[model samples]
Target: MTTLPTSTQKKLGLVIDLDTCVGCHACVVSCKGWNTENYGAPLSDQDPYGAAPSGTFLNRVHSYEVQPDHGQAALVHFPKSCLHCEDAPCVTVCPTGASYKRVEDGIVLVNESDCIGCGLCAWACPYGAREMDAEEKVMKKCTLCVDRIYNENLPEVDRVPACVRTCPAGARHFGDFADPDSNVSVLTAERGGIELMPEQGTKPVNRYLPPRARDRTEDVDILAPFLDPIAAEPQGFMGWLDKALTAMPGGR
Candidate 1:
Protein backbone atom coordinates (compact mmCIF):
# COMPACT_ATOMS: atom_id res chain seq x y z
CA MET A 1 0.00 0.00 0.00
CA THR A 2 1.10 3.55 -0.78
CA THR A 3 0.86 6.63 1.43
CA LEU A 4 -0.88 9.99 0.87
CA PRO A 5 0.89 13.34 1.16
CA THR A 6 1.06 15.03 4.56
CA SER A 7 -1.37 17.81 3.52
CA THR A 8 -3.08 19.29 0.51
CA GLN A 9 -2.73 22.97 -0.39
CA LYS A 10 -6.41 23.48 -1.23
CA LYS A 11 -9.52 21.35 -1.09
CA LEU A 12 -11.61 21.78 -4.21
CA GLY A 13 -14.82 19.78 -4.13
CA LEU A 14 -18.63 19.87 -4.29
CA VAL A 15 -21.49 20.42 -1.86
CA ILE A 16 -24.70 18.69 -2.92
CA ASP A 17 -28.12 19.72 -1.67
CA LEU A 18 -30.46 16.78 -1.22
CA ASP A 19 -33.55 18.86 -0.49
CA THR A 20 -33.39 20.80 -3.76
CA CYS A 21 -32.39 17.90 -6.01
CA VAL A 22 -35.34 16.59 -8.04
CA GLY A 23 -33.56 13.42 -9.25
CA CYS A 24 -33.77 14.72 -12.84
CA HIS A 25 -30.52 12.90 -13.83
CA ALA A 26 -29.31 16.02 -15.61
CA CYS A 27 -26.08 16.02 -13.62
CA VAL A 28 -25.56 12.35 -14.37
CA VAL A 29 -25.87 12.85 -18.14
CA SER A 30 -23.76 16.00 -18.12
CA CYS A 31 -20.98 14.29 -16.20
CA LYS A 32 -20.96 11.32 -18.59
CA GLY A 33 -21.00 13.51 -21.68
CA TRP A 34 -18.20 15.78 -20.50
CA ASN A 35 -15.89 13.36 -18.71
CA THR A 36 -16.10 10.69 -21.42
CA GLU A 37 -14.66 13.22 -23.85
CA ASN A 38 -12.66 15.51 -21.54
CA TYR A 39 -10.50 12.69 -20.26
CA GLY A 40 -8.42 10.74 -22.79
CA ALA A 41 -10.71 7.69 -22.92
CA PRO A 42 -14.47 7.53 -23.57
CA LEU A 43 -16.76 6.03 -20.92
CA SER A 44 -17.54 2.42 -21.85
CA ASP A 45 -20.81 0.51 -22.25
CA GLN A 46 -20.60 -3.25 -22.61
CA ASP A 47 -24.21 -3.94 -23.67
CA PRO A 48 -25.70 -0.53 -24.25
CA TYR A 49 -28.44 -1.81 -26.58
CA GLY A 50 -28.87 -5.21 -24.96
CA ALA A 51 -31.60 -6.45 -22.62
CA ALA A 52 -29.48 -5.74 -19.57
CA PRO A 53 -27.50 -2.68 -20.53
CA SER A 54 -24.82 -1.31 -18.23
CA GLY A 55 -22.09 1.30 -18.49
CA THR A 56 -19.39 2.99 -16.41
CA PHE A 57 -20.34 6.46 -15.16
CA LEU A 58 -18.65 9.02 -12.93
CA ASN A 59 -21.83 10.40 -11.43
CA ARG A 60 -24.84 8.48 -10.08
CA VAL A 61 -28.04 9.67 -8.44
CA HIS A 62 -30.21 7.50 -6.22
CA SER A 63 -33.64 8.10 -4.70
CA TYR A 64 -34.54 6.67 -1.32
CA GLU A 65 -37.72 6.65 0.75
CA VAL A 66 -36.80 7.38 4.37
CA GLN A 67 -39.55 6.76 6.91
CA PRO A 68 -38.41 8.16 10.25
CA ASP A 69 -39.56 6.58 13.46
CA HIS A 70 -41.77 9.57 14.37
CA GLY A 71 -42.13 11.44 11.09
CA GLN A 72 -43.58 11.10 7.60
CA ALA A 73 -41.84 9.30 4.76
CA ALA A 74 -39.34 11.57 3.02
CA LEU A 75 -38.24 11.10 -0.55
CA VAL A 76 -34.55 11.97 -0.77
CA HIS A 77 -32.41 12.36 -3.87
CA PHE A 78 -28.78 11.39 -3.33
CA PRO A 79 -26.02 12.13 -5.82
CA LYS A 80 -22.78 10.18 -5.47
CA SER A 81 -19.30 10.59 -6.95
CA CYS A 82 -15.64 10.52 -6.01
CA LEU A 83 -15.34 12.65 -2.85
CA HIS A 84 -11.59 13.39 -3.21
CA CYS A 85 -10.90 12.53 0.40
CA GLU A 86 -8.10 14.00 2.52
CA ASP A 87 -6.73 10.63 3.66
CA ALA A 88 -7.87 8.75 0.57
CA PRO A 89 -7.58 5.04 1.24
CA CYS A 90 -7.87 4.46 -2.49
CA VAL A 91 -4.49 6.13 -2.89
CA THR A 92 -2.82 4.00 -0.22
CA VAL A 93 -4.22 0.73 -1.65
CA CYS A 94 -2.71 1.20 -5.14
CA PRO A 95 0.22 -1.13 -5.61
CA THR A 96 1.47 0.57 -8.78
CA GLY A 97 0.92 4.15 -7.53
CA ALA A 98 -1.66 4.64 -10.32
CA SER A 99 -4.20 6.01 -7.87
CA TYR A 100 -2.92 9.22 -6.27
CA LYS A 101 -4.18 12.44 -4.79
CA ARG A 102 -3.05 15.82 -6.08
CA VAL A 103 -0.98 17.64 -3.49
CA GLU A 104 -1.98 21.10 -4.73
CA ASP A 105 -5.76 20.67 -4.99
CA GLY A 106 -6.58 17.41 -3.21
CA ILE A 107 -8.24 15.87 -6.31
CA VAL A 108 -7.81 12.10 -6.47
CA LEU A 109 -7.03 10.72 -9.92
CA VAL A 110 -5.58 7.69 -11.66
CA ASN A 111 -2.64 7.30 -14.00
CA GLU A 112 -4.39 5.17 -16.60
CA SER A 113 -1.17 4.21 -18.36
CA ASP A 114 0.30 2.72 -15.18
CA CYS A 115 -2.94 1.21 -13.81
CA ILE A 116 -3.17 -2.57 -13.25
CA GLY A 117 -6.98 -2.80 -12.70
CA CYS A 118 -6.48 -4.57 -9.36
CA GLY A 119 -9.86 -3.22 -8.03
CA LEU A 120 -8.16 -2.47 -4.72
CA CYS A 121 -9.11 1.20 -4.91
CA ALA A 122 -12.76 0.32 -5.32
CA TRP A 123 -12.62 -1.93 -2.30
CA ALA A 124 -10.80 0.75 -0.31
CA CYS A 125 -13.47 3.36 -0.91
CA PRO A 126 -16.39 3.30 1.54
CA TYR A 127 -18.68 5.37 -0.71
CA GLY A 128 -18.40 2.94 -3.68
CA ALA A 129 -17.07 5.74 -5.87
CA ARG A 130 -14.70 3.76 -8.06
CA GLU A 131 -15.65 2.12 -11.40
CA MET A 132 -13.91 -0.42 -13.60
CA ASP A 133 -13.53 0.10 -17.36
CA ALA A 134 -13.63 -3.41 -18.85
CA GLU A 135 -12.23 -2.41 -22.23
CA GLU A 136 -9.34 -0.36 -20.91
CA LYS A 137 -8.92 -2.70 -17.96
CA VAL A 138 -8.33 0.30 -15.68
CA MET A 139 -9.91 1.56 -12.49
CA LYS A 140 -11.64 4.93 -12.96
CA LYS A 141 -13.25 7.56 -10.77
CA CYS A 142 -14.38 11.14 -10.98
CA THR A 143 -11.65 13.66 -11.78
CA LEU A 144 -13.82 16.58 -10.73
CA CYS A 145 -13.55 17.72 -14.34
CA VAL A 146 -9.91 18.65 -13.71
CA ASP A 147 -9.36 19.30 -17.40
CA ARG A 148 -12.34 21.64 -17.69
CA ILE A 149 -11.72 23.54 -14.47
CA TYR A 150 -8.18 24.48 -15.53
CA ASN A 151 -8.71 24.88 -19.26
CA GLU A 152 -7.97 28.46 -20.28
CA ASN A 153 -9.45 27.96 -23.76
CA LEU A 154 -12.99 27.61 -22.40
CA PRO A 155 -15.11 30.63 -21.49
CA GLU A 156 -14.44 32.07 -18.04
CA VAL A 157 -17.91 31.14 -16.80
CA ASP A 158 -17.84 27.61 -18.22
CA ARG A 159 -14.79 26.31 -16.36
CA VAL A 160 -16.75 24.37 -13.75
CA PRO A 161 -17.50 20.64 -13.81
CA ALA A 162 -20.17 19.80 -16.40
CA CYS A 163 -22.41 18.32 -13.71
CA VAL A 164 -22.31 21.63 -11.81
CA ARG A 165 -22.95 23.64 -14.97
CA THR A 166 -25.82 21.45 -16.21
CA CYS A 167 -27.61 20.93 -12.91
CA PRO A 168 -31.08 22.34 -13.76
CA ALA A 169 -32.13 22.68 -10.13
CA GLY A 170 -28.84 24.25 -8.93
CA ALA A 171 -28.46 21.37 -6.50
CA ARG A 172 -24.69 21.00 -7.01
CA HIS A 173 -22.04 23.51 -5.95
CA PHE A 174 -18.28 23.66 -6.47
CA GLY A 175 -15.70 25.62 -4.49
CA ASP A 176 -12.56 25.50 -2.40
CA PHE A 177 -13.45 23.88 0.90
CA ALA A 178 -10.24 25.13 2.50
CA ASP A 179 -11.69 28.61 2.47
CA PRO A 180 -13.96 28.91 5.46
CA ASP A 181 -15.95 31.69 3.71
CA SER A 182 -16.43 29.84 0.45
CA ASN A 183 -20.01 29.23 -0.64
CA VAL A 184 -19.60 25.47 -0.23
CA SER A 185 -18.24 25.97 3.29
CA VAL A 186 -21.03 28.35 4.33
CA LEU A 187 -23.73 26.08 2.90
CA THR A 188 -22.22 23.10 4.64
CA ALA A 189 -22.09 24.90 7.96
CA GLU A 190 -25.62 26.28 7.63
CA ARG A 191 -27.22 23.07 6.37
CA GLY A 192 -25.34 20.64 8.62
CA GLY A 193 -23.74 18.88 5.67
CA ILE A 194 -22.31 15.43 6.33
CA GLU A 195 -20.02 12.85 4.80
CA LEU A 196 -21.47 9.57 3.59
CA MET A 197 -20.41 6.65 5.81
CA PRO A 198 -17.97 8.81 7.79
CA GLU A 199 -16.98 5.90 9.97
CA GLN A 200 -14.55 4.74 7.29
CA GLY A 201 -12.34 7.77 8.13
CA THR A 202 -11.59 8.85 4.57
CA LYS A 203 -12.36 12.52 5.41
CA PRO A 204 -14.12 13.06 2.09
CA VAL A 205 -13.92 16.63 0.87
CA ASN A 206 -17.34 16.57 -0.81
CA ARG A 207 -20.20 17.21 1.59
CA TYR A 208 -23.89 16.34 1.34
CA LEU A 209 -26.49 18.80 2.59
CA PRO A 210 -29.26 16.77 4.18
CA PRO A 211 -32.87 17.37 3.17
CA ARG A 212 -34.26 20.54 4.70
CA ALA A 213 -37.16 20.65 7.08
CA ARG A 214 -40.71 21.35 5.81
CA ASP A 215 -43.90 22.33 7.53
CA ARG A 216 -46.37 19.43 7.58
CA THR A 217 -48.97 21.03 9.84
CA GLU A 218 -50.97 22.38 6.88
CA ASP A 219 -53.22 19.73 5.39
CA VAL A 220 -53.75 19.43 1.63
CA ASP A 221 -57.19 18.74 0.19
CA ILE A 222 -56.77 15.59 -1.87
CA LEU A 223 -60.27 15.78 -3.45
CA ALA A 224 -59.91 19.34 -4.74
CA PRO A 225 -60.90 20.07 -8.37
CA PHE A 226 -58.09 19.57 -10.86
CA LEU A 227 -58.91 22.74 -12.78
CA ASP A 228 -60.34 25.79 -11.05
CA PRO A 229 -63.06 27.89 -12.78
CA ILE A 230 -62.70 25.93 -16.03
CA ALA A 231 -66.33 26.36 -17.08
CA ALA A 232 -67.49 29.13 -14.75
CA GLU A 233 -65.10 31.79 -16.15
CA PRO A 234 -63.65 30.95 -19.54
CA GLN A 235 -60.72 33.38 -19.84
CA GLY A 236 -57.37 32.03 -21.10
CA PHE A 237 -55.83 28.95 -22.70
CA MET A 238 -57.57 26.52 -20.36
CA GLY A 239 -60.86 28.44 -20.84
CA TRP A 240 -60.58 28.13 -24.66
CA LEU A 241 -59.92 24.39 -24.35
CA ASP A 242 -62.93 24.01 -22.05
CA LYS A 243 -65.16 26.04 -24.41
CA ALA A 244 -64.05 23.96 -27.42
CA LEU A 245 -64.74 20.75 -25.55
CA THR A 246 -68.26 22.02 -24.74
CA ALA A 247 -68.94 23.02 -28.40
CA MET A 248 -68.16 19.50 -29.73
CA PRO A 249 -70.85 17.33 -31.41
CA GLY A 250 -71.60 15.38 -28.21
CA GLY A 251 -70.42 18.17 -25.89
CA ARG A 252 -71.60 18.41 -22.31
Candidate 2:
Protein backbone atom coordinates (compact mmCIF):
# COMPACT_ATOMS: atom_id res chain seq x y z
CA MET A 1 0.00 0.00 0.00
CA THR A 2 1.23 3.47 -0.85
CA THR A 3 1.47 6.15 1.85
CA LEU A 4 0.17 9.71 1.75
CA PRO A 5 2.24 12.77 2.47
CA THR A 6 1.71 14.32 5.88
CA SER A 7 1.21 17.71 4.25
CA THR A 8 1.36 19.39 0.89
CA GLN A 9 2.91 22.72 -0.07
CA LYS A 10 -0.20 23.72 -2.02
CA LYS A 11 -3.77 22.46 -2.27
CA LEU A 12 -4.68 22.86 -5.92
CA GLY A 13 -8.16 21.83 -6.95
CA LEU A 14 -11.44 22.83 -8.60
CA VAL A 15 -14.44 24.83 -7.31
CA ILE A 16 -17.62 24.12 -9.19
CA ASP A 17 -20.78 26.26 -8.97
CA LEU A 18 -23.89 24.14 -9.33
CA ASP A 19 -26.13 27.14 -9.99
CA THR A 20 -24.17 28.33 -13.01
CA CYS A 21 -23.64 25.03 -14.78
CA VAL A 22 -25.99 24.59 -17.79
CA GLY A 23 -25.43 20.85 -18.41
CA CYS A 24 -24.06 21.60 -21.89
CA HIS A 25 -21.30 18.96 -21.55
CA ALA A 26 -18.79 21.31 -23.19
CA CYS A 27 -16.25 20.57 -20.46
CA VAL A 28 -16.63 16.82 -20.97
CA VAL A 29 -15.94 17.11 -24.72
CA SER A 30 -12.99 19.43 -24.18
CA CYS A 31 -11.48 17.12 -21.56
CA LYS A 32 -11.74 14.16 -23.92
CA GLY A 33 -10.25 16.14 -26.79
CA TRP A 34 -7.33 17.59 -24.84
CA ASN A 35 -6.40 14.45 -22.91
CA THR A 36 -6.61 12.20 -25.95
CA GLU A 37 -4.51 14.49 -28.13
CA ASN A 38 -1.85 15.55 -25.61
CA TYR A 39 -1.90 13.54 -22.38
CA GLY A 40 -0.88 9.90 -22.19
CA ALA A 41 -2.73 7.27 -24.27
CA PRO A 42 -5.72 8.25 -26.36
CA LEU A 43 -9.14 7.52 -24.83
CA SER A 44 -10.78 4.73 -26.72
CA ASP A 45 -14.45 4.31 -27.70
CA GLN A 46 -15.94 0.89 -28.41
CA ASP A 47 -18.27 0.95 -31.40
CA PRO A 48 -18.88 4.65 -31.01
CA TYR A 49 -21.52 4.85 -33.71
CA GLY A 50 -23.16 1.60 -32.72
CA ALA A 51 -26.20 1.13 -30.51
CA ALA A 52 -24.17 0.16 -27.45
CA PRO A 53 -21.27 2.64 -27.28
CA SER A 54 -18.83 2.91 -24.43
CA GLY A 55 -15.71 5.00 -23.94
CA THR A 56 -13.24 6.29 -21.38
CA PHE A 57 -13.72 9.80 -20.08
CA LEU A 58 -12.07 11.53 -17.15
CA ASN A 59 -14.85 14.10 -16.73
CA ARG A 60 -18.64 13.79 -16.82
CA VAL A 61 -21.73 15.91 -16.10
CA HIS A 62 -24.81 14.60 -14.32
CA SER A 63 -28.17 16.37 -14.23
CA TYR A 64 -30.67 16.00 -11.41
CA GLU A 65 -34.11 17.49 -10.88
CA VAL A 66 -34.38 18.90 -7.39
CA GLN A 67 -37.64 20.04 -5.77
CA PRO A 68 -37.39 22.72 -3.15
CA ASP A 69 -39.71 22.77 -0.16
CA HIS A 70 -41.66 25.84 -1.34
CA GLY A 71 -40.46 26.49 -4.89
CA GLN A 72 -40.62 24.82 -8.29
CA ALA A 73 -38.36 22.00 -9.41
CA ALA A 74 -34.96 22.88 -10.76
CA LEU A 75 -32.41 20.99 -12.80
CA VAL A 76 -28.85 21.00 -11.52
CA HIS A 77 -25.85 20.01 -13.57
CA PHE A 78 -23.07 18.44 -11.56
CA PRO A 79 -19.65 17.82 -13.06
CA LYS A 80 -17.63 15.03 -11.50
CA SER A 81 -13.92 14.22 -11.67
CA CYS A 82 -11.06 13.25 -9.44
CA LEU A 83 -11.10 15.33 -6.25
CA HIS A 84 -7.42 14.55 -5.45
CA CYS A 85 -8.28 13.85 -1.85
CA GLU A 86 -5.77 14.42 0.91
CA ASP A 87 -6.54 10.98 2.34
CA ALA A 88 -7.17 9.34 -1.00
CA PRO A 89 -8.19 5.69 -0.62
CA CYS A 90 -7.34 4.97 -4.25
CA VAL A 91 -3.69 5.85 -3.65
CA THR A 92 -3.26 3.53 -0.67
CA VAL A 93 -5.32 0.72 -2.14
CA CYS A 94 -2.93 0.23 -5.06
CA PRO A 95 -0.76 -2.80 -4.39
CA THR A 96 1.80 -1.82 -7.03
CA GLY A 97 2.24 1.69 -5.61
CA ALA A 98 1.25 3.07 -9.00
CA SER A 99 -1.15 5.56 -7.39
CA TYR A 100 0.46 8.36 -5.44
CA LYS A 101 -0.20 11.88 -4.22
CA ARG A 102 2.24 14.68 -4.87
CA VAL A 103 3.50 16.41 -1.76
CA GLU A 104 4.16 19.64 -3.64
CA ASP A 105 0.62 20.29 -4.97
CA GLY A 106 -1.47 17.51 -3.37
CA ILE A 107 -2.48 16.15 -6.75
CA VAL A 108 -3.24 12.43 -6.65
CA LEU A 109 -2.03 10.72 -9.81
CA VAL A 110 -1.53 7.21 -11.08
CA ASN A 111 1.72 6.24 -12.73
CA GLU A 112 0.23 4.50 -15.76
CA SER A 113 3.35 2.52 -16.66
CA ASP A 114 3.33 0.78 -13.29
CA CYS A 115 -0.45 0.19 -13.38
CA ILE A 116 -1.59 -3.38 -14.07
CA GLY A 117 -5.25 -2.39 -14.59
CA CYS A 118 -6.13 -4.04 -11.29
CA GLY A 119 -9.23 -1.80 -10.96
CA LEU A 120 -8.40 -1.18 -7.30
CA CYS A 121 -8.34 2.57 -7.72
CA ALA A 122 -11.71 2.56 -9.42
CA TRP A 123 -13.19 0.50 -6.63
CA ALA A 124 -11.62 2.69 -3.97
CA CYS A 125 -12.84 6.01 -5.35
CA PRO A 126 -16.18 6.96 -3.79
CA TYR A 127 -16.98 9.54 -6.48
CA GLY A 128 -16.55 7.06 -9.33
CA ALA A 129 -13.90 9.25 -10.85
CA ARG A 130 -11.51 6.56 -12.10
CA GLU A 131 -12.06 4.42 -15.17
CA MET A 132 -10.25 1.66 -17.11
CA ASP A 133 -9.02 2.65 -20.55
CA ALA A 134 -10.56 0.31 -23.10
CA GLU A 135 -7.58 0.40 -25.45
CA GLU A 136 -4.63 1.01 -23.12
CA LYS A 137 -5.90 -1.47 -20.51
CA VAL A 138 -4.92 0.92 -17.72
CA MET A 139 -6.71 3.11 -15.27
CA LYS A 140 -7.41 6.75 -16.19
CA LYS A 141 -8.68 9.74 -14.24
CA CYS A 142 -8.46 13.51 -14.28
CA THR A 143 -4.92 14.77 -13.87
CA LEU A 144 -6.29 18.30 -13.45
CA CYS A 145 -4.60 19.01 -16.76
CA VAL A 146 -1.18 19.00 -15.07
CA ASP A 147 0.70 19.31 -18.38
CA ARG A 148 -1.30 22.39 -19.40
CA ILE A 149 -1.12 24.21 -16.05
CA TYR A 150 2.67 23.98 -15.68
CA ASN A 151 3.66 24.43 -19.30
CA GLU A 152 5.74 27.59 -19.58
CA ASN A 153 5.18 27.72 -23.31
CA LEU A 154 1.43 28.23 -22.99
CA PRO A 155 -0.21 31.57 -22.26
CA GLU A 156 -0.68 32.46 -18.61
CA VAL A 157 -4.47 32.65 -18.99
CA ASP A 158 -4.60 29.13 -20.45
CA ARG A 159 -2.75 27.52 -17.55
CA VAL A 160 -5.80 25.78 -16.05
CA PRO A 161 -7.62 22.48 -16.29
CA ALA A 162 -9.26 21.74 -19.64
CA CYS A 163 -12.71 21.55 -18.03
CA VAL A 164 -12.24 24.94 -16.36
CA ARG A 165 -10.98 26.58 -19.52
CA THR A 166 -13.79 25.27 -21.71
CA CYS A 167 -16.68 25.84 -19.31
CA PRO A 168 -18.99 28.24 -21.13
CA ALA A 169 -20.95 29.07 -17.99
CA GLY A 170 -17.77 29.88 -16.04
CA ALA A 171 -18.98 27.41 -13.43
CA ARG A 172 -15.60 25.73 -12.92
CA HIS A 173 -12.70 27.47 -11.18
CA PHE A 174 -9.16 26.20 -10.62
CA GLY A 175 -6.77 27.62 -8.05
CA ASP A 176 -4.70 26.90 -4.95
CA PHE A 177 -6.90 26.36 -1.94
CA ALA A 178 -3.91 26.67 0.38
CA ASP A 179 -3.74 30.38 -0.35
CA PRO A 180 -6.36 32.35 1.55
CA ASP A 181 -6.39 35.05 -1.12
CA SER A 182 -6.93 32.66 -4.02
CA ASN A 183 -10.15 32.96 -6.04
CA VAL A 184 -11.21 29.43 -5.20
CA SER A 185 -10.63 30.03 -1.51
CA VAL A 186 -12.62 33.27 -1.41
CA LEU A 187 -15.43 31.77 -3.47
CA THR A 188 -15.64 28.77 -1.22
CA ALA A 189 -15.98 30.91 1.86
CA GLU A 190 -18.51 33.27 0.33
CA ARG A 191 -20.67 30.57 -1.26
CA GLY A 192 -20.41 28.02 1.53
CA GLY A 193 -18.85 25.39 -0.70
CA ILE A 194 -19.35 21.80 0.38
CA GLU A 195 -17.38 18.59 0.09
CA LEU A 196 -18.75 15.51 -1.62
CA MET A 197 -19.56 12.70 0.80
CA PRO A 198 -17.78 14.21 3.78
CA GLU A 199 -18.63 11.13 5.86
CA GLN A 200 -16.30 9.07 3.66
CA GLY A 201 -13.31 10.75 5.40
CA THR A 202 -11.55 11.35 2.08
CA LYS A 203 -11.03 15.07 2.77
CA PRO A 204 -11.51 15.89 -0.90
CA VAL A 205 -9.87 19.06 -2.09
CA ASN A 206 -12.51 19.88 -4.69
CA ARG A 207 -15.55 21.85 -3.52
CA TYR A 208 -19.06 22.39 -4.88
CA LEU A 209 -21.14 25.55 -4.48
CA PRO A 210 -24.81 24.86 -3.89
CA PRO A 211 -27.48 26.29 -6.15
CA ARG A 212 -29.32 29.36 -4.88
CA ALA A 213 -33.03 29.31 -4.15
CA ARG A 214 -35.10 30.05 -7.22
CA ASP A 215 -38.04 32.46 -7.36
CA ARG A 216 -41.40 30.86 -6.68
CA THR A 217 -44.08 31.06 -9.36
CA GLU A 218 -47.05 30.13 -7.17
CA ASP A 219 -47.84 33.75 -6.22
CA VAL A 220 -46.96 35.31 -9.59
CA ASP A 221 -49.47 35.94 -12.38
CA ILE A 222 -47.50 36.17 -15.62
CA LEU A 223 -50.46 37.12 -17.79
CA ALA A 224 -51.99 39.68 -15.39
CA PRO A 225 -50.85 42.67 -17.49
CA PHE A 226 -52.21 41.15 -20.69
CA LEU A 227 -55.58 40.55 -19.09
CA ASP A 228 -56.07 44.28 -18.48
CA PRO A 229 -56.24 46.70 -21.46
CA ILE A 230 -53.67 49.50 -21.53
CA ALA A 231 -55.99 52.06 -23.09
CA ALA A 232 -59.64 52.74 -22.23
CA GLU A 233 -60.27 53.92 -25.85
CA PRO A 234 -58.51 51.84 -28.48
CA GLN A 235 -56.84 53.66 -31.43
CA GLY A 236 -55.55 52.97 -35.00
CA PHE A 237 -55.55 49.37 -36.37
CA MET A 238 -56.15 47.76 -32.97
CA GLY A 239 -59.12 50.11 -32.40
CA TRP A 240 -60.61 49.20 -35.79
CA LEU A 241 -60.13 45.51 -35.11
CA ASP A 242 -61.74 45.74 -31.66
CA LYS A 243 -64.71 47.71 -33.03
CA ALA A 244 -65.18 45.18 -35.85
CA LEU A 245 -65.02 42.25 -33.44
CA THR A 246 -67.54 43.93 -31.11
CA ALA A 247 -69.85 44.54 -34.10
CA MET A 248 -69.68 40.81 -35.06
CA PRO A 249 -71.90 38.06 -33.59
CA GLY A 250 -71.95 38.27 -29.75
CA GLY A 251 -68.51 39.96 -29.79
CA ARG A 252 -68.73 42.32 -26.79
Best by TM-score: 2
Q: Per-residue lDDT of 1-252 in model 1, one digit per residue for the tens?
A: 257988888999999999899999999999999978768567888889999988889899999999988778999989999999998999998999888889899899998888988999899898889999877788878999999999999997889999999998999999999999999999999999999878888899999999987777766676676756545676789888989999998998
Report lDDT per candidate.
0.90, 0.93
Error of 2 at 169 (Å): 0.9
In model 2, the number of clashes is 0
| Model 2 C-alpha lDDT versus the unseen true structure | 0.93
TM-score of 1: 0.86
Which candidate has the highest lDDT of all? 2
Off by over 4 Å in 2: 216-218, 225-252
